[model samples]
Target chain A: MLADGLRRALTLLLRGDPEVLGIAALSIRVALVATLLACLIGVPIGFAIGTTRFRGRRTALTVLNTMLAFPTVLVGLLVWLLLARSGPLGGLGLLYTWWAIVLAEIVLAAPIAAALTAAAVQGIDPRVRRTALTLGAPAWRVHWVVAREVRFALLSAVVVSFGRVLAEVGAAMIVGGNIRHQTRTLTTAVALATSQGDFSLAIALGLVLLALALTVNVLLHMLQGRGDAGAA
Target chain B: MLALRDVTHEYLGRVVADIPALDLPAGTTTALVGPNGSGKSTVLRLLAAVEAPSRGVLELHGRAVRSSAERLHARRAVTLVEQHPLLFDMTVAANLTDALRLRGARRVDGRQISEALELVGAGSLAARPARALSGGEAQRVAIARALLLAPQVLLLDEPLSAADRAAREALGNVLAALRDRGTVVCLSSHVLEEAYRWSSRIFTLVDGRLEGMTPENLFRVDLPPGTGSREVRVGPLRFSIVTDRSGPAIIAVPPEDILVSRTPLDSSALNQFPGRLTAISEDGHGRIRLAVDVGVELITRITPASLSRLELQVGTGVVLSFKAVAVRVF
Candidate 1:
């Protein structure tokens, strides 16, 4: 039975099944949007925290680092409450929409982006900051120079956050409602297909998801290797 | 002039640097000579506006540099090159040009970049990746980057630490050129001879305190009570200084007045010691400074020809003679 399902899965994937394509496309779109938003909101905050010294900075950093390991289901529960009917944001009616899934993913991905970015920024040699400042670079320019110097690490943060958002299931299922053809992502579809005893569809979606992750990671690795070589 | 008034900097409630007063005049090179942990780099950073003193004020041209605006303005004119300068992850030319571009230079000509690099003897490294360059090469590029700005006050911390002998000499000449161009150049070095040779004035720091400023051999000696002349003993060696001051006093002997001979000299000079040559080093200007130890180490400068004429080597026996009048007691 497993062999038969595997065979049927490959055939469906090769035949360009519309439902499978739509789920995969939605997964990519949602993950990309969440990752982009996370980066936009996280990079600057991380950079500031990484470079500056102030009262409460240690506590702030500790909090951010702890957020990197936060459970996605908790994030989904929190976000779900915020957007659910009769919840504070019930007026928007976005509970079962793609935006709700993106929001949940963002809540899940932003901390990873922030924490990794902070680590990358802090990993830069302190001499780089001193040299730039001594050369009359203003504070903002110093940060910019440091960011460029650690671009490889920053790129890794983005890739890692994207992968996290793409692979996440609990948050998307809870907030997105897994509405077929509208908000169903690869991970949610695989879950629904398996529970419904549709082994062929489940196997097909799982293989496509794995392939997408492998391809993205491989491309990022190649880029990072090139960057390292160029730096060397 | 860059002046520090009642400056003290602390880190985590521990005092790191404290200078009651200091005046670094324009158009002169001053060397901050001390050992590690002596707060030399802290002084340079404070002067460069890379950091602010925990107390008191640092002023430039009679204006208090307290505000960020003032510090930013001063930073444009005063740049500090670190002990281990970090080159941006780019071509050496780009590193130099980036500094120029950051300083708001609209048109960065390649010739200007080349000229700056050539001045620091890093011309060949223009096309090379800065991160791939050797330590000495990176230091030279850093100096070139600083020089491109034509800053008014240039502070360097151990600029020659990573340089080879030839590069050290080249950098020394570049510093002289910078001083001649009326830039107030200050550098920190643990090499006393190099500091004495390169600086018009030298500030010695011991345990984060400014000890002295005379360009001479300084010795903390105790003097017995005397009226006109006092016998000062440093280690096992004794020297007479013509001073009315008694008790603990610092004595300085000008290197030029200290004469080295192969044999004991029968002369009117009041001080003489039979010592051995401990080390021979150049003063970056073709002159040699010989480290001789009788009971205490005394440095005497001579020409390279004289060094060879005397057949001096490490551990060679020599006699050092100096007159009491040449000793300045403070």
Candidate 2:
């Protein structure tokens, strides 16, 4: 039975089974969109909090750090509460839709991006700003130079957020409702397949995830090599 | 001209710098000579207008640099090179190009960048990555980057602290040329003679207060073991000091503290050296300066009346005397 399942998994992937290909495409597109949104909302906040000094800055950072370990199911519940028919934001009727799942994934991963971005900016050499300023750079240019200095760390924030989004199952299952062809992601499909004892499909989706992770790693390695060439 | 008026900066609730009316006029090199924690760097930062003063105003050409608009002008007019300047993670030429762009250069010519590099003795380093250079090489590039700006006021915190001989010579000449072009160059150093070599005016900062330590007759002395005897030997002469420090130290004998006489003094001035005068010139302060080769060269300031009374001339025998307390040991 195990050998038969392995052959079926390879056939599903090699022959590009329509269902498996659709699941993988939806998973990547959702994760990329959610990661982009998270970065857009988080990078500026992180950079500002990391570089400037003000009251309540530490409190804000503490809150971000706390959310780095946030439970994804809890994030799904929050999204459900907001998007459900009886909830405050339910007027748009987005519950059980892919948008609801994207919202859940964003809540799950935005904190990771934010906290890591703040850490990245703070890890930079403190003299970068002073050096840029001394060279007659304007305030905006100084901030740009500082951001450029930690671009690799910033990219790490995005990559980690994307990873979190791709690997999350509870949020996708809770809000996405595991509907086939519309909101079912690779993670949710794997969960459904295993529960129904469809070992071939489960193994096929798992292999796809592993391949995706490997591709991300290879790309990250190449970018890091370029970054090191630009830095020490 | 850059001036600080009633400027006081506090760090960690402690008043670290307090200056009431300090002026850095263009067309000269002024050195702030001091040790660590003396607030020289703080003063330089304020002068650069990059760091705002806690109280009072930083003025440029009699206008206050308080608002952001004025601050932009102040920053463009004055620039600072820190004790350990930072270089961007890029090629030397790229760094200089960025600096030139920030300097408001309409056309950032590649030739201009390399010429600035050549001025600071880093011409060959243009193609090299900044992180690959040695400490001295990095510093030369940093100075070149700053010099390319051509600001009216240039502040440097220990600009030559990590420089080599060739780098030092190149920077000195460039700074001299900048001064000639009416740039106000302010540099800080712990070495008084090195300050004298680079600056025409020296302001000594001690515990965050400025005292004019005339950059003359300062010498580095070595005290061997059992140095508690308060005596140091340099070359062929034994000098008396009032410090408990043993090993390498610096001592300064103020020119005005030395008394010149024709005969040996029977009084309590402990250090008396007999030597012939080498040169006589104006002290620039309504007095005359006499250089006497007393084992080590000693500079003495005397009034014209006293000079005539002693009939001192070049190559005449004279006795220079100062008390042990006159020697400042650091």
Best by lDDT: 1
Residue lDDT tens for model 2, A1-232 = 7788889999999999999999999999989988899889888888988999999999999999888878888988888999989999999888888888888888878788888878988878878887777777778888888988988878878887888888899989999999998899999999999999999999999999988888777767776787777666
Screening candidate 2 with a backbone cut-off below 3 angstroms (N, C-alpha, C), the clashing residue pairs are none
- TM-score (C-alpha, index-matched) for candidate 1: 0.81
* Deviation of model 1 at A222, angstroms: 3.8
RMSD for all candidates, in order, please. Answer: 9.4, 2.5
lDDT of 2 at B166: 80
For residues B173-252, could you state the per-residue lDDT of candidate 1 as single tens digits? Answer: 78878967999989998777778777888887766778744345777677788778657778887896788888765577
What's the true lDDT of residue B329 in model 2?
Answer: 71
Cα lDDT of all candidates, in order?
0.86, 0.85
Best by TM-score: 2
iRMS per model, in Å, is: 1.4, 1.6
> Candidate 1: RMSD over Cα atoms?
9.4
Model 2 DockQ, alpha carbons vs. true complex: 0.56
Q: TM-score of candidate 1 restricted to chain B?
A: 0.69
TM-score on alpha carbons, each prediction: 0.81, 0.92
